[model samples]
Target: MHAAVGLALISLLILLLLPFAHHAVLFGAEGLGIGTLRDTYLIAVDAPFGNLAISGHMLAGAVVTLLAPLQLIPWLRMRHPGWHRWSGRVITLLGLVTGAAGLVHILSRGTIGGWVMDLGFGLYGLLLMLACVQTLRTARAGRMRDHRAWALRTFWLAIGSWLYRVHYGLWYLATDGLASNPDFSGTFDLMQNFAFYLPYLLIVELWLRLQRRGV
Candidate 1:
């Protein structure tokens, strides 16, 4: 029953992520001159480094979004421990790549919403990289309990890009785009810049606390 539930959730997550991943891959390719679907705003013709950084972030983020959830399936970890270990390594590596590239882009080109968005996203990237490092460090030290806690944090951050879009989509559908603008400097936009990952991370921290308390 647990396996079934896990599979169902993972499947749903993949389904929701399919389009986002596809777009990321395509956009990344285009930014790198592998394709012609370029958006000048995202991939400036004059800024190769910034383009590369953002493109790499998107591509790695797409893969992380797809793979992170599989790492959580209890049956997969119990039955195929080797798979878990190797996949964890890939996820951590890509998570760092995603975070680093994002930071690079933000620092180089900045976000459309100006310094506020840059600050919010910059912090998000820093936290993501930190989680990835902590996850790997704990695992390497054979600290399984600490490893699991960091791994859960890593998973949430791995899919945060997707969650950011999901939050905007729901908000637009409910309010017809209140407190949002193309520049992404509106009140809701400002809140959303940090909301997608911070709240989730906070919840994970709470859950970890409960586990520690035997609650």
Candidate 2:
């Protein structure tokens, strides 16, 4: 059941991000600031460094999302260990780069929730970097079990970007669209800041504990 849910979420994220990846490849950062999201991308475009960070975040995010699901499939690891290791290394490096770039975006541009949102996402990026480092360290140490646990934690946090959008889409539908809906903007902003990432960390902690107990 958990595996099925994970696959569904991964597929959903891939579907959502694939277009952005193509747009980025074909048109680059200039292509992103359009439609309802034009303002956000415009803000990033205003500053040279902001453009770099956001572009790096977008591309690296797409790369990690593409590689992440494959890492979780047991058969791939068993049958093609070499590919798994190489891909894992690439994912780890890209994940760290993207996390740092995300934090840069949050701190430099700010967000709808202000400091609260910045702090929430800032910490999420911090946690992701820590998990990525620990996963790599454990892998180098030949501690496969610990490495796998950290890798899963890293994967969960890495997908927070996609999960946030999913949760926001559901909320948008519940409120019959966010168009001219200023009342719920604050609430939704706050929720999106923490909803997907924090709970996921807690759940992974519990899963690790249960696994240790042979559950």
Candidate 3:
């Protein structure tokens, strides 16, 4: 019970913190503007299209934030009949819209953040699209369990947005002084996406294996 409660509190904290993290541009390249939200990130009405795109991303982030966590809900637990099927349907549809928008927007990001960012987002987007197809194909054949299983795969990919912030935050906290570690900073920045999700995927695979073993 204590563990569950702790996890729930952490999740709540994450939900509360999510919006600020999503507006990462507000915080600048290194995520600097911590307590400075709306005003600090405010755009003059002069840049309407740029404003629209950023707003779209924040909206997309909101959708992803709300939907990604649903996979962990108790009702959609492995044993909950029909729950997985229904949730998987919702996830796949949203995943398509969100993932496609993400890919297109990356081209506009052409920053010093480099190809790794593009690569990471692109790979994640493709994996999600493929995972959705995998789930849909299975669902069409009435293989409901297969649909649930693969939907979890796609769901993890969708959560990469949050996962990126998780990694970026930890990196900043660890490095402390970016100037002293130029080579290290660049290297870490390039590898951030890979580091963020590699272990996550490994753990997910382990969990799925345990689930298969009926634990």
Candidate 4:
């Protein structure tokens, strides 16, 4: 059942990532699909560094998203230890770059929900960097178990944007599209910024504790 749930979650994430990857990464680069992207890369025309930062964020995010699920698979890890190590190194690098680029974008452009959202994402980016560094540190120290725990933490935070969309989509549907309602949008935006990554970190910590106990 646990394996089934994990596979299901991964499948859903892949589904969610596909269109964005296609439109934003592939088509948007060629100046083809800006209309489909909500934020639109054309806005990047005015801020060159901001454009570079977001492009790096999206590119690194794609790499991290693709590699993270593979890292979580026990069979792959056991069967190909070398692949795990090398891929993990790449994932760590990409995750750090992704987080840093995101921070750059937020600092340069400022996020919605004012300073509250900025604070939330700022902490999220900081934690992502710390978790990724700890992942590398633990692995280098020959602490495989601790490394895995930190890697899982890093992966969870790396995909926080996807989780935010998932949560927001469900909530929007449940509230009968309250995201479209001007008055309620601010509350939802704030919730997505803070509740998304922070609660996920707590859940990942709880899972790590349970795993350590062989639960």
Please report the candidate that would top lDDT against the real structure: 1
Q: List the global CA lDDT of all models.
A: 0.90, 0.75, 0.61, 0.74
What ranking emerges by TM-score with the best candidate at the front? 1, 4, 2, 3
Q: Estimate, for each residue in 1-215, the C-alpha lDDT of model 4 and write its tens digit.
A: 58768777777777776665554365324332244435453345556566677777777777776777777777678889899889988888978897898898788887655687788888888888888889989999999888888987887887776676778789877996664444334667767677878888899889888887999
- TM-score of structure candidate 3: 0.66
- Which pairs in model 4 have colliding backbones? none
Q: Of 2 and 4, which scores higher on TM-score? A: 4
| Candidate of highest TM-score | 1
Per-candidate Cα RMSD to the true structure, in Å, reads 1.2, 3.9, 6.0, 3.4
lDDT of 3 by residue, 1-215 (tens): 47577558547956855675555434332222234335523233455544444445545555555555665565345577476567667667756755665665566543235576678767777777787778778978988678667767765666666777777677688986343243333666767746566667678788888988999
**What is candidate 3's CA lDDT for residue 18?**
68
For candidate 3, list the clashing residue pairs, or say none: none
- Runs in model 1 lying further than 4 Å from the true structure: none
Off by over 4 Å in 3: 1-17, 20-55, 76-87, 108-112, 177-185, 213-215
TM-score of each prediction: 0.96, 0.81, 0.66, 0.82
Model 3 Cα shift for residue 64 (angstroms): 2.0
